[model samples]
Target: MNKYNDYAKKMNCLYAELPEYLTWHKDSKEWEPRKKQEVIGRIFNCHPSDGEKFYLKLLLMHIRKPTSFKDLRTIKGKYFDTFREAAQYLGLMETDSTAEMCIEEAATYLMPAALRQLFATILVYCSPKNPKQLWLKFENFLSQDFEHKKTLNQYAIKHKVLDIIAYHLDSMGKKLQDFFFVDDDIVTRTHDNLFKEIQTERDIIIPTEDLLAIKQLNEEQKVAYDQILHHVNNNIPNAFFIDGPGGTGKTFLYRALLATIYSAGHIALATATSGVAASLLPGGRTSHSRFKIPIGENNSKPCSISKQSALAQLIKSTKLIIWDEATMAKRDIIEKFDEMLRDIMSSNIIFGGKIIVFGGDFRQTLHVILKGTKDDIIDSSIVMSPLWQHLHKLKLKQNMRASLDPHFSSYLLKIGDGIEYTNDKDEIQIPPQANVPFIDDNTTLNTLIDMVFPNINDENLDFSLFVNRAILTTRNDFVHEINDVLINRFPGEETTYFSCDENTYTCTIPDQEELFHSLTPQGLPPHKLTLKLNAPIILLRNINPNEGLCNGTRLLCKGFTPNIIYAEISVGVHAKKTVFTPRITLEAPHDNFSSIPFKRKQFPIRLCYAMTINKAQDQTLDFLGVYLKKLVFSHGQLYVALSRARSIEQLKVLIRPSTPLIQSTDYTKNVVYQEILKATDTH
Candidate 1:
């Protein structure tokens, strides 16, 4: 195990996830074919455009790698002056290159309607920064074929194209106006297929389990529930916040509320700031995906929802919006939702006079900024927003987990509340009995793994057992390293898939290309993925939130196709259900992940044997393992990682017991922003 662990530390990417239909460029991670035979192999799976069938056949008969792009385009021993005449080509456009290459390839033979579908696919998957530019550039190619003998003018042709694109975007609960500017003068439609969205909400099955839970609310839970019901029952839409720590039955209260609202045939939308938390709520979805909340530096932009769009109608009809883990979201996100709601509902009140319940613990992790400081993080919290003062704060002080271990529960409170005794570095000394002994790095990790996931290599052990435990660290690097060792020891033959990598900016220096291959930016997956059947993984992108496929969702690999992997949702409400995952191009949210900005095309998943402490938020495990090789650097990170289990007895921690400049006794750093805590205190 140690040998394999050491070997994987130096990543040599030869793992094969898909059949070797493609090969990697030497000394680089770019996805391109150097040989005629490689391109021919790819063409076999996908038919070529006009004038290529005969040329392709002739070339396949005599195949070899070409010295350059010009040589590769040579067909039937004769060169096609331009790349287009060749069977496989990548035409880079100056603006929106990815979207252009995507459309140009399909434009050769696909019908105008099919091209529209391709255009929508690019919008959904590729996420072009300027959709308007792409549409304008590809307008002619997206029109009806001239062979049909239709003599429509340019204006009429463009109108037809817009209608088709609008229809396609509407089906996905979006509108072209979302990506296009308001001044673009899109042909407006009051509504389209939003009835289907409303129906899906109406069709939701209020679980009998949740129905029964309505009667089981504890005393504190009852108070919060009654306040929400009074607001909803009286048609007085108001904004309220529920302050509850982990194991305080926050999700329990959410389900009961959903059941009552859903029982009355009224729509109640359940959303959370993070996917892990969202998956726990019945009919839950991330607030960002559900609301089209913009991501990145511009946190103050309103949601991408159009006023007359289907999502607007859904929001208008929703009787209650319960946002869980509200503390983790930036103030801009919530305020932006509030602004959009007011515009849609035509009201000046907070959240557009809608019944919205924000539930979370300020003691847990707060909104994350890439390099945010103490003041930066506190300023980003919703508590800093002027709207926070108006929120009727409700408290749930009775933690459900307290019944299991009162001492552990109270200890966690002290840690979260920042009342625990700490040294000058603001680091708390953990009880020696509270931590697994740290003999050495290797021994500590091995012990933690054994404690959380025993018999990990046993083929006969149920795979479901692996889903109930995970090793968490504050850094993504640690998670990746630990997951690599654990996956190497799992009981199946391994398959690895290499992602197609390219820098966003034209690469000028050698270091930029190297960074692209190794970069695994936030929200973007890695270039090389190694996996085995039944290996546990988590979704890194929000594919289909309605189907229980969201970021941070846990799944187990079941099978693989040419470029797809089918998996079973190992946890959450959709557990045991199978879904096929397709390769999508994911762009990093920031340029800082590498020296140069880049995008990756791969399956949006990561091994879930371990995950970052932030990603593990909102998830509770019976058996938990935490490897704190590095001190947590952000507010509430230590508290979040430590509180992910019901009791200390069920948890294991592997940390260095010695510090360089100070006396250490099971001590580690704990960051708490007291200013935000003081402002958000529910008491």
Candidate 2:
């Protein structure tokens, strides 16, 4: 270790202690070739937004002197012209055409290919204290190489030679007893020559293979997608919102659109609200991360793209941008991106001349704050805020999961009511249905464990738990309570408690936490995380808090503040000679009864078992049971529950109404009836 440390210290002295131009500034001091970068702070003083003059000046310094005007003209006309043409051919044009055209013949002849060496020399001389000695050393060094003439092409081809030469020179051990050092002014003059040669190539060409793949589209998809494509082909800016529920081939359609545009020789970009959502679309990244927009600090400033940055060019050239999970994106974030696009395109207008297709459900909005006046849905929560209403909205009402149960899907969504279910062929097991057990008894608990345990035994269970109410208390003391129960009884049960009352709100146990950490520790990843859970215990919102109802709901568990609790229920069982009861009511204990506000509805208490109605919310439970208690349908609750299930056969209802569960509500019936009518009218 000592020997290794000695060697490292020696190397650091050799390279780090070199009296090169890089040592001029502190940031340049750490330039270790491969790992460190020479700090080239954005030269804000230059005009034309491109460093053409800066690059040209650096190039001129390398040649030092010219023998004749014709020689200078040959160097300028042949070399400079060739390089400039190449840059132009590659679409490296920046915002400054006049500045780029300032390349004169005399200057070109005087500069030659000395940009790299000049950079190195200037970097070394930037250090005020060591400037003079470095200058004398550089002068002596240059005298030896003055007779040699290096062309731009040769310098480019032998870039490593300069690096190696500098490395070797810096490696030489000092043997002098005393030597007179040069002055800082001389050091500055000598430093000017350091960047004479182009040490490293600046830009590289990336193959468009990965980008091309995103543009492949099927004929069917292209037919449905051509409207936007045609607009882009005509160089018109357009925005589109493709809203559909969880499934309906939104992602597939996006891919087809991308492929069609790219195949037509157009560039395409993709973004999303969060990283997890972004992953749903091809070439995914969160909007903020993709655009590199600084949040909070400078909300007004948009991310800009310089032509010098290759990635900026790539984004600028892209003809289409597909943003998935659009609902989760805030108007400010979109606005910031729009600002960046306009800046890059050099236009005062919006959207950077690119066609953007947004895909997301407005109902699934993750943004807690409202952004603009457009596309604003005036829910009480966002009534006071400015709303950026989205234009060009397209509704995808067709439910692919409807194949699981078309009528029940419609009914569940309409009334916020859930249906009863028996078993899931997907898991080869039965899951608990609805918040209230079919019979409102302890027998439901037994039935649930019996049906669910066998399927759980067949495979390694890994899934997310979604519960509405606590079986025990109203306060969030359930983290340890729930953890202890599962650990003590089930032993190896993996669980995550989504406690709204708790400060952290939600934390997954082991697997889900690991997955979340891997994907999105900052917040929601760019893509939605979909994983299977086993023995997933959920606390349902069955009891009233005033009546000691624990505030538990799927939204709460999934991380939402419960704004209101509509009703309360109380049910329980006392087993003989046991500290713990075999069954507990999903209802809140009637202790804090005075806190709840007045309401017209009557609440019933039950075991708070997973009810069949929650199937509409897209969860698959694995315990079969029936609700024997008389069920009163809330305006929207029942519909949300029933629609969560994959299929209707999974539910088993004992006391369900003779007609559909939601036969009464005007809104429920309207949506269900309207969609059917639309289908009929289309047919």
Candidate 3:
């Protein structure tokens, strides 16, 4: 059995000896044992046995209570005092001079084997100089070393240590800050300070020269712009939805609106569903970051923002809130924001009587709930929200992306609208130029790769070429495979980083270890990740927004330090700039697995020669290769993959060959929920 289980069993044995302390409850008509704290405190109060005092001290150290610093210090001192007493009483620390030696002696003799090992590991890995850094390093070490042991996981270690520290602090009535230099509360405050700093430093200076460069808006765009501008200018309460397909100048219109609003010295908060989309806007932020939207949906609780908060002040003074790529967000999020605005601004009208504009194509992917059914998805979509009906719809028709190639633009529109030509079997035919015919051999894969990533061995290839070309895939497995193959082709010495994986739970139950080992969800980084010089990688976590190392930011591997990976920014506003990315712990959500309730920690970087279409959403690429090893499963997957490329020549598709080849090719299935389209059409 694991050390935790052994310790728990020992504790339970001690609990079994408390018959005299049992209270008879008249309501329940049963004898109930006293609370754990009362029991531990009572035992400690008495001139207890060495074992009893040691266990009590340990238990008290793990209990969490909110108290003052003096009390916390007293509790901490009590724990060490008990440890020293226990060691002396047991004749284990007769000559041990150091506190660490005393602790080791006391823990070895009095604590359970599992806890003994844990304490040893903590001491070996951590130091007092940088407690937080030490704790983090210790946790990483545990994850890597004890991953197979089933006694330690990231969550378990974090909670276990924090609880021990918190309990002692609580007993002394002190905060964790008194003991450890780092704590969650401190980190949260730091982030809040950073947010305020960003807000204050963020200059929304739209260059007058750039605004002058913008030509006249088309007829469709003109109508939408005029209406939005009028509403903002007159202080009219309005909620508008700008419905446009990819490359229809929604961004163009958005910029114009932002420029006009900024020029007039009015606040126009530009936000998007994604980081990439948000970056396209003038002083834009992701809606979640800007509004402090909770990670999970909770209808009962509003946003964490209070009326006195700086964010609240910003919202109050804001003239317009333009949420780009709105269709990607869940309806509940929109409703929650609405509720928060109403609560904050004290208005019953939609979005607290503010002019909020949401823009995105309904034809694109909606709210993506993992493993959710089609019905679940549609229900969660923003179009299904009650507030959607209140939205004034504005459509942008002329395709700005394909304005030079009108025929190609028409073809794209047909595909997106699901009006593309199909045979009797309902299979769409691939255009001759766009389709890379599948030759019935392994060379087909090689041919496709050569065409997509040409001059792979060229030493002097510009970094822009890497940014321009990407292979899009339906599955993460294919993405990994293609990335591996492509990275190998790149001329450089490779550096492979192996992730430390561990079961976060110390399971006493049978077969739990086996179960955890089998669980590998999507979005979790692999055990072994390889990188080479000039190879591209995508950031899985938001490292630093100021340096443009946010999630979805792409970087090309340039060099490496002993502890950090140096890379040049390959995408976003900080493109071509070199940045240092450190090895940081990242935890994939537990909910994505079988409700296992354990986070998998790993480095937050992934190879990016190819990427899943879901990750590629809202990103526009110059050259895209759609390699379909399997059929596109989710809604708008095919459309999203195809629409990533700017023009026809820039895109290439390679489908798996059919045994009985015919005139019609097996194209990607287009899943458009007709009811949603109908609802939007009527609006």
What lDDT would each prediction earn against the true structure?
0.75, 0.35, 0.65
Using TM-score as the yardstick, the better of models 2 and 3 is 3
Q: Candidate 2 — which residues are off by over 4 angstroms?
A: 1-224, 261-266, 294-308, 369-390, 412-644, 650-683
Q: What is the C-alpha RMSD of each candidate to the true structure, in Å?
A: 11.0, 28.3, 17.9
Candidate 1: segments with Cα more than 4 A from true spot? 1-123, 126-194, 423-426, 506-512, 657-665
Q: Pick the candidate with the highest TM-score.
A: 1
lDDT ranking of the models: 1, 3, 2
**lDDT at position 385, candidate 2:** 18
Worst 10 residues of 2 by lDDT: 573-582
lDDT of 3 at 292: 70
Residue range 1-683, candidate 1, lDDT tens digits? 11233332232222221113334566785444233443322233222233444334323322333334555576546677654445332111122354666566556544566567557656777678887788778877778564255787776666667766665565445667777632355445423345656876888888899999989999999999998999999989788999988888989999999999999999999999888788888888899888888777655677877788767889888999999999989887888988889899998988899999999999998887777778888887899998899999998899887888998888889999889998776678776666876777787788888888898899998877777788889788888889888998889887766566666776464424334666777766666688998998999977667667788999999875434566788878778767656567777766555656777777789898998999998888878888888888887888899898878887877776545553353778888878878998642
- For model 3, residues 600-620, the per-residue Cα lDDT tens digits are 333468888898888888888
